[model samples]
Target: MPASGPPDQGEGKRRPLTALEDGYHIVTTLGSAATVLCATAFPIWLSRVRDNARALSGQSPRYARPWLYAGWIVPVANLWVPRGIVADIHRASAPGERLPHAVNWWWGLWLAGMPSGTGLMYAVPTDHVIERAYRQVYPLLAADAAVVAAVVAGVFVVRALTAAQRRRGVDSVRARPTAEATGRA
Candidate 1:
């Protein structure tokens, strides 16, 4: 039989959340909502860009349109498909150019962050994570660093891809009049 006094004094009883814990909960909730929003919107944006890339490069897509979203969720395939998708976009946008380094860096760091404390924070309860943090902090810190690096690399990838597509579009427009003038259009 367990004897209870104050909640924190009891072996099995739960205590009221501290202000920091409460704030953590709120922040995590908001982060989760934002993640959902981004998850939904990202695939749509990727699909549009992929179509444009295909048209610009005159090459068929490496993966079908649906893979933009599924590639992230599917097991095993997830490891490579998402990277492939981004690579395809860059390749198509700049056919003769080498692939951007940011794409590889982003994917590598993203993968490293997963299966770390950062990923565990998303998978486990907040209380459990806070408790674990007291005992082991380095893993969490490393994970966070990886995730942050991934985000920075991801931004570079987006900029590179967007710029490549813009260049391709401008080149296509410039070539159009020439083709017509040469009776090739």
Candidate 2:
């Protein structure tokens, strides 16, 4: 029978979360702004990255496969690509057995920011507007930003606490030992 008093009692003490988690969340939240920012920034970033890649490889810009081109330019597909890439990046950076909090933060802000920013920039504008209508839009957009900021901040707090718990050697607060397991451990 496995012996235990507290969970993770004999497992080597876990290290505190590295700064990477905090930095990753911050960068991701900003990057999620790319959905709107990307409407303006992605094409530029993509162009630069592509140009750099081509220059390094000495390859001419060849026609990309139709699906590849479509995946990037199409609305629904574009969202998925960036999201998947961010998740993959988070997965790569996280320690084994640790949940990828970075992925959660990235996805939450990315999904929320995209629709919120896009709605503010594209949907709210009208063919005809009253004089003060434009002025009102900015405040609405500011409110959206504030809400997103709160959500992102909340994500960071949860992630930080989880990391601290891990460092203190509580493997998982949600885990419950079975009757036999509890007696043995």
Candidate 3:
């Protein structure tokens, strides 16, 4: 039999979204934005702190601050580059202090989730088919789970290291000593 409306190709015709789906879309969009901000800010903030800590301690980090930001944005290098930069920052943030477990957890979860979030997983059908629909959905779910874990672990690492640095009396990594601090007009 012929289909009713415009051809949907293999998929069925689309229907108007219910209020729940609409609300879900809105929330996910906002949540995604927040996720992006946190993801970017985590590396940059840590990198800056690490840089300052290194400068104050008379030692240099293997990963520069700019690489911390740009590495994640670049292609072919993002796989391990950002994680390496963050690991370096994690190490340098607190001189002579052991890297926290949260750092390792974050790296592990990030590596686990990276493939799921990238071109490896495509959005597949959400139907209840055993092989047809689930192969795609499961990966996305796993990816989301891993990413959430990574973000939480990152929060832990950032808070712990930031507090550690402040307790050790490291200067702010804002690229300038303020007039009040410098005591200069």
Candidate 4:
């Protein structure tokens, strides 16, 4: 059946994104969300590690940023936090390069997937089999776990690339000759 609602006239109103764009968005959004969750979780886990180390050494441990916890609980903030996390990931990955590829991927997915997912979820389902299957599967954690894993992998790839860049930067700095030695005549 054809769509019944009024047409969308937003930017690029001539037409909506193609199927490729929709797939890209879904995958990217999943990756971005996974990355953000992992990044935040890793830091918190490290903080716990720090606390344990400190306790073993008879020193006080520092806590992880409270914002990490805040991001998970707050609604609007959750969206914005992921963006910031991705930006930070990009920055951490490449000091001067354009935002990491993951950031672009995340934005692409989020822009396309979010609205589509919301619409698909809310729109009255006409197809019996699809509606029944969706209802049956949607509530299961397995579906969410698969999505989460894909997203996390996307974030991980970005992180790996960034770490490589940082390593190169460090190596170049270490390779530079001392001015005193270079000036010897």
**What TM-score do all the candidates reach, one by one?**
0.79, 0.32, 0.69, 0.37
Which parts of model 4 are misplaced by more than 4 Å? 1-64, 107-158, 161-185
lDDT of 2 by residue, 38-157 (tens): 355534433433333333334443433342345455787776764443333223223243445554565465556554343333533221111122346574465467556745654563
The lowest-lDDT stretch of 10 consecutive residues in candidate 4 is 169-178
For model 3 the TM-score comes to: 0.69
lDDT against the true structure, per candidate, is: 0.73, 0.42, 0.63, 0.44
Q: Could you tell which candidate, 2 or 3, scores higher by TM-score?
A: 3
lDDT of 3 at 142: 83
How far off is residue 40 in model 1, in Å? 2.4
Candidate 1 lDDT over 1-185, as tens digits, reads 11322223346668776666678678767757766776677677677678778777788989987788889988899989999999998888788999999999999998888668444226676766665565677887787788778878988987888778766543233123234345565
Per-residue error at 122 for model 3, in Å? 8.4
Q: Which candidate wins on lDDT?
A: 1
lDDT order of candidates, top first: 1, 3, 4, 2
Count clashing pairs, candidate 1.
Answer: 0
Off by over 4 Å in 2: 1-73, 94-99, 118-143, 146-185
Query: Worst 10-residue stretch by lDDT in candidate 1?
Result: 1-10
The top-ranked prediction according to TM-score is: 1
Model 3 error, position 130 (Å):
16
